[model samples]
Target: MRQALLLALAALVIVSCGRRGPQPQAVEPQAFADTTPPSIIYPAFGDADPHPWEDRHPGHYPVHGLDVSRWQPPIDWRTARASGVSFAFIKATEGGDFADPKFDEHRRGAQAAGVPWGAYHYYYFCRPAHEQARWFIQNVPKGADLPHVLDMEWTPHSKTCRIRPDGRTVRAEAQKFLDILERHYGRRPIVYTTVDFYGDTDIGRLPKTEFWLRSVAGHPRNVYPRAIWRFWQYTGTGLVPGVQGKVDINTFNGTPEAWAHWKAGG
Candidate 1:
């Protein structure tokens, strides 16, 4: 399999960041094609403040990955790949003008390390959905291994654009964004959201796309009730080698074969 070949032939390695002041340049990872993960790609990761699972744990899942942005910087992607970082969703554009500084670097590194990577846009209420979609398309390149994500969550603490539309308006806006991205990228975009937003906006009613629910305290079935999900963002305080500070950890809700089939766009 492609994943086995990449894992066996490639020796992903990196230099850990240990400085206090200016962050040093990361060792460039060797080129490797992004492919479906090997069977049972166990997550070799940790959490700063671990949540006790009363039911099925994140580790029980066969495939695991992470999401990162400017907040978790100076990552050694090679080391992360070696530590079973099967896939990654890197934050790209937000609103209209805001772009992530580390997006290009993160995407490249993840690709080179053979980690399937995609970009995500943080939904901003102020901007028009089409404008934000265009902005995201302008930034994140095509041909990402995984489908891109639209992070739809309420930002009440924002300095600008804190307005919360009703569920109908929210779903309409989300569908517009999803339609634009699906047409542009040739893959249906996934929705990443929090419990509160899911409750208020009723975005679960959004059509024809998978959901990546953030339920750190418990399983999605427990938190999201009857809603089905593809990915689960279980923790934000995750720790892994090569990545500085805490990062978001997630799990795929399927077996190795199922994950491979999904990655193949089956």
Candidate 2:
């Protein structure tokens, strides 16, 4: 009887030891250092001064960034960084089935050049929000340093989706997309909007979500009028160094220290 009891105890000990939980994986810290020196002349768009939309002075916002898509020429991220571009939002996907062909190159190049980048999806009003959200999730990788964005705008002229949904329907669709992305990425997503879309959908009342407002003609305060904005895209015809053609210029709505805190996932 004593020998049998000893064997049973030994078996139990082995079983318990074998059932240990999985070990945690190590995550490498992301680099956010800006090494671009002052006095570096960025490329110009044309003889007309490519950046003519500088309604506000550079001293107003210490942190600046840009948004890019395939329409922009191949980017020299190193030069962009040196030109004081602190971050970038790269177009990753659109609609339900369309993925940006240059997404992989842009993502890899931005990281290699030490630029913090986020992916943005161009929302299609014709498609279901859940389907578009899943498509974006499948395309963009997890654990990105910056928050994902849903670029919503009035596509009255879209060849694909010309029909505009009602304001309530638009708001519901946006909510669904935001929820799905937030759950998958473990961070709240941003809603990018134009003046027309904001007025159409009344997106300013979205609960607990940050906004990236596009008001190229004037400050968001004057254009959006009482709407809260986190990032303000001031110009779409911006000329930055290391980038050919035109690019979109944007600024964070806070000081450099505040931007650092936000970038650190605060």
Candidate 3:
């Protein structure tokens, strides 16, 4: 009984008291698939390690999704989908060569489960942007339900590439990558970035580009000033049902109607 209490206390520290949305019943939480209208379903997931949000809590947003890599064990995409996981972004490739072994499995799993899934390419500074884009295309198949993402960030610990290019160079490379993907995929890709990288490169300067910003400690408005963001990655240690390990969690920046429209590629 004491051990149970200790476990409960550990879980209690990772709560979003700021979540001001309707929560599922504590007795039997509502499955997102079973929700009425299905457009606005807030899957009341837990966080293994959470950042207390003072405002703009992720739960307040009706739509949520997750990003997965090989670091995570095999995910039960059907279970995840039914549990308010409206979308998924799987890591596909990195640099010009290293393709994630789990990409094919995850992509197929998400598709079979009827989840709106897309692939994202992690940036490598040492590699040419065009080569990286081609590598991603080669690995991730065409005709996905969502736009692909370019994950550009500073790789400080990378042995092969530790060089930080100037804002101009970074912008140029990003544009090249974006344009190539758009031409090939017929959809403008979203750029996923973190705070420090955004601060250094000023990626928002890129023309006609959408962003998925990572701001775990605070709202995107507080971290990414003046930059319009479509998705906000609010936590890295989110605990969702059907996933074996902690995963990154994100929420759409719009209402159910807007989410439907956007996901329809409008």
Candidate 4:
């Protein structure tokens, strides 16, 4: 597939300030024509809409949300919520080393804003799944709204890239981490990866896991073979009102009730 090809070629590989310095520039990702189906197009939800809000506001989208690590600025969560952010994912830790300093405050602030939250750990292929799982279990706090994520990708520019593991090894380790996270959090963890990364890894093997897919052009199914995406991030540099800068835009799958069921595991 195109994604698989990109992943093989990628050998390849976010933002902001105050807490920790930004990582080095990432390699330019290989672009692919989006071929996802229209039935899977993520529509706006509830009273808060992402399209018109962003269009009318010029740079702001309502219900817009973002993820951050030490390299990114400390977001004004309250402002973000007031402006209409419904959810967020914070970087908690990476591999078996390096924890984001802003995670604690971001977690608290987002909760205070009444936003549903999730946490992500940058995957290091060189690390053992058990080791990384243990690290995540040790650091992230348990909470009602928190879901865990596995950030899998090929980071060619990474200082730690030399030891990047193969896709099968990557899937094995990720599954281990996901299993541990599910045990601690009492919910099936989400898998976050670019289309290319997903195709490169054995993601299809973990069919039970919900996916948080990154597809800039269209829905995941059109772009991927038998894609089962629960979340679709359509844009990364999306301009939204109320927020200070560009924010990532995503669509949750299913209807309102479906969203509720997914959220409550009902």
Could you tell me the lDDT of residue 55 within candidate 2? Answer: 45
* Tens-digit lDDT track of model 4 for 1-266: 99998876654331223247667533212112222333342323232233433211212122335666665466677766666566788889987887889888888888888878888898877778888888887888888474678888778788755565677787777788888888878987888888777777767567467777887655565666566666667666654444445556665654445455656764
List TM-score per model, in order: 0.83, 0.80, 0.84, 0.72
Q: RMSD of candidate 2 to the true fold?
A: 17.1
> What 10-residue stretch in candidate 2 is worst by lDDT?
27-36
If both were scored by TM-score, which would come out higher, candidate 3 or candidate 4?
A: 3
2 or 4: which has the higher lDDT?
2
Give lDDT tens digits, candidate 1, residues 1-266: 99987775554422233325666433212111112333333554789999888866777776889899988777898998888788999999899999999899899989988899989999988999999999999998888999999999998899998989999999999999999999999999999999999998888877676889999999787888767588889999999888999999898877677787888786
Ordered list by TM-score, greatest first: 3, 1, 2, 4
- Which is the better candidate, 3 or 4, if ranked by lDDT? 3
Whole-model Cα lDDT of every candidate shown, in order:
0.84, 0.80, 0.85, 0.66
* Higher-scoring candidate on lDDT, 1 or 4: 1
Best by lDDT: 3
Write down the worst ten-residue block by lDDT for model 1.
26-35
Q: How many clashes (backbone atoms < 3 Å, residues ≥3 apart in a chain or on different chains) does model 4 have? A: 16
lDDT, residue 35, model 1: 26
Between prediction 2 and prediction 3, which has the larger lDDT? 3
